[model samples]
Target: MALKKKKSKKMTSTGTDVNITSLMDVLTVLLFFLIKSATVSSLELTPPKGMKLPTAEMKEEPKEAIKIALSKDMLVVDEKTMVKLDAGRFPASYLMEDGRTIKPLKEFLVQEYQKKKDFYKDVADENVDLLPPPTLLIQADHKLPFGTLKHLLHTAAISGFADYQFVVETPGE
Candidate 1:
């Protein structure tokens, strides 16, 4: 019997191939840019003393806003303050337990809105090269009564503060 030898076929000429180092560098730069942009988009919220915030599932962050602080006894909107019903002192008009009186939040919100608008106008002019439109930021206490929150919401809506960013805690953190 005669033995037959098998021949091997060559697949390529030289081992030199395309260099991917530049491609890898570009990808790394792109990744870093994306990470930085994502961080710049979210907003942070901090509650006041003795006040906790509720949580939400939405992750959107609004830029530029007026902050509203809701405490157990008071409601604060950028230096403007109002005492809650339990405090026995009403600012304007509020419904009493007897339903004879009322402490409305309209005036306060209107005043605040005007103040903010003027301030923004001045600042916007000074920094024509920069600055953006304003938005509303609500940082109500978690334990705050629903009535206070509802009234504030209404006031804000009426005052042209339609855009709102409700500050809250992140779950499981």
Candidate 2:
């Protein structure tokens, strides 16, 4: 007697497409969490000795950045004295050829700005205009001359450090 042979069916993919919207939504939320957790939002800054800081009702802590501090006898950056002020004024020789920029401060600021730019180079978006500007955190004595800050700001702007923030003493709650 001859036995009948049975044919096996093969499995094949269907025409239905996979929906990726849910996967994309999950990825976006993870990216947001990583960005928020990785950054430092507060700074540990101490006022220069013998310097009086202005008080404020600050709602948030200062973020980390390059710091510049000015006092009567000296000018400091990152806790290092950059220059010895002559009664709260920079020396005439410290001025650059343009007669506006401070040489030492400009040099330091430019180098720092370059480093920051390079760090953000890979992080830059398609539009160069959207790149974040370099920032400076300034801590100055309340009695400092407006001219002093004005000069510093002008010099910094030339070095591409246009966005700056001030560090003031926050009063107790």
Candidate 3:
């Protein structure tokens, strides 16, 4: 029997490298989408110092309004210092002698109304006879006294801010 020469097989190597550039591009797009959606769904409101917001069951979304923030030590209107609380008391500069109407607050509201009216007048159509009423948003601490809130509402009504809304926190499910 003739012995056949043994044939040696050449060794061939198979590479196992993985391409991750496409996967990285997809993950980057997903991250961007999540960040954009989170910002769009969240409300932008900052409570003042020492203020804990009240919780409510209401589902209505708040509209644009002049924000009035009330904390234990200060009262801010649209980020402007309206009154400084002294020893847990409302400032005398804002309160009238009768202690019923908040004069300074009313005056500020009237000035704001005038400014908005002028702006609207310049931008509104001549055929429009009346403009929509302005809205006011009150952000009061949960521990705030009822009497203080009552006075604030009364003052706001007198200042022609009949459309008012209270800012509160909604309990999470």
Candidate 4:
């Protein structure tokens, strides 16, 4: 009897097939982390001290603003007054060359109004009507009474400056 030869079975590897689900999960997690890392910050600006401003009923704020100053015995605009600042007694020598120096509060406000009006005409864009009105910020010492501020406001109104903003300290420290 001849010996029978047994054939061995050949083992072949299966073709490479990658599972895309795992890769897609990793990509999605990376995308989520990248988006979460990004951030934005907001900023706000505040005015200086001793310049506490009065509030208005309107919620929206204006773009253009002007500042005026009030002092004892005299009114000044933007901290600059025609009359000189002194502890006591008004000086005679401090006078403008035009001879018509600022002696009254109304005159000072009127002068400022005229200047602003002319300036608005020169720089204002012609295309836009009802342009932003210039806001007048009046800063008066706490000691000063409301009468002075009222006069200043009246003067501004007369000179076509209808918009007004009062600068004052908040009540109660």
Candidate 5:
């Protein structure tokens, strides 16, 4: 009877291919996370109670901006109630001498404009024209009087917000 012994081999390094697919997948996930985190949303807009938004055929998507919502008995700015309405209208005490100026709304908008300035101050320093334009998103009851809207617009203009977007619901939704 005879027995055979196996020969020992020395371990050595060999060229190996990198798994670029897995690496790319991890990088893709990280990129998506960073992109999502870096974006700052203005606010979530849920239709206030007792308010019906008008429907429209939207041509473009709305961007991030300050929101001015007029509910049944309140005026809201970015979800914060700025003025409590009286019978769906602003209280007399909330108006200025001009009668069209919404005192509380104007004040809150001015403060918000200042905040936007500070937030984009660095950008302004780089290029004065690069600063984001002050914009407002107006959400109001469909039955609101045109006069009230006019006053709201005037107040927003005086408060330094020059651009506006009227919020609306689309058909079938």
Candidate 6:
């Protein structure tokens, strides 16, 4: 006698769903890391108004110093206006009669030096006989003339700020 064939059972699958929650978490962590790295790698300091800094291939970070910003129409020291240029010319109040020394600028530098000396003395908690040399940071416009910068440097040297660092913008990658 022929026996009835046993009923066969078939199994079917609708589809497969992928789990991406872990992937999303990893991506979020990576994004945050990149943002933090970008912010920490760069220093932020606004240049004077109407000033365009020159680009350089050098990659040295600037240290804290007395900032001197020179634009076409203004000369700022530590964000204070020491002189104003009139039609690309320095006024008499800014320069001496000999035209070799910047009177106001020198005075400002001297005052700053005295203040720094006092700060050093206070920090040492003793009467310091000799203080460290002053550090000057120059942020000049790219369009500024060499003669003007030279004169400014001369004034700084005479005012006891012999060490100088020129602040330039880094070139774009």
> Better model by TM-score, 2 or 5?
2
Going through the candidates in the order shown, the clash numbers are: 8, 0, 0, 0, 0, 0
TM-score per candidate = 0.51, 0.69, 0.73, 0.41, 0.68, 0.73
- List model 4 lDDT by residue over 20-104, tens digit each: 9989999999999878864343312233344335543443333345566655544455555545334422343432343224335
For model 2, residues 1-173, the per-residue Cα lDDT tens digits are 67766666656767899999999999999999888766464567878889897777775556678888887678788899988878777778887887668899999988987676666666763344566786888888888888777778889899888988887876654
lDDT of 1 by residue, 1-173 (tens): 66666666766688789999999999999999888665554545556677778888666656656677766577666646655645533444464343332334456556766776677768675543333434577887676666556666665676556667778766642
Q: For candidate 6, lDDT tens digit of each residue in 137-156?
A: 89999988887787788899
Better of 1 and 6 by lDDT: 6
lDDT of each: 0.63, 0.80, 0.79, 0.54, 0.82, 0.82
Model 2 local distance difference test score:
0.80
**Candidate 2 regions with alpha-carbon error over 4 angstroms:** 1-42, 123-129
For model 2 the local lDDT of residue 68 reads: 89
Stretches off by above 4 angstroms in model 5 are 1-43, 126-130
Worst 10 residues of 5 by lDDT: 123-132
When 2 and 5 are scored with lDDT, the better candidate is: 5
For residue 29, give model 4's deviation from the true position in Å. 32
Flag clash pairs in model 4: none
Better of 5 and 6 by TM-score: 6
Candidate 4 structure, TM-score to reference: 0.41
Instruction: Give, for candidate 4, the lowest lDDT window spanning 10 residues.
Output: 39-48
Compared with the true structure, the alpha-carbon lDDT of candidate 6 equals 0.82
Q: After superposition, how far is residue 13 of candidate 4 from its true place, in Å?
A: 57
Q: For candidate 2, report its TM-score.
A: 0.69
Query: How far in Å is the alpha carbon of 85 misplaced in model 6?
Result: 0.7
Clashing pairs in 5: none
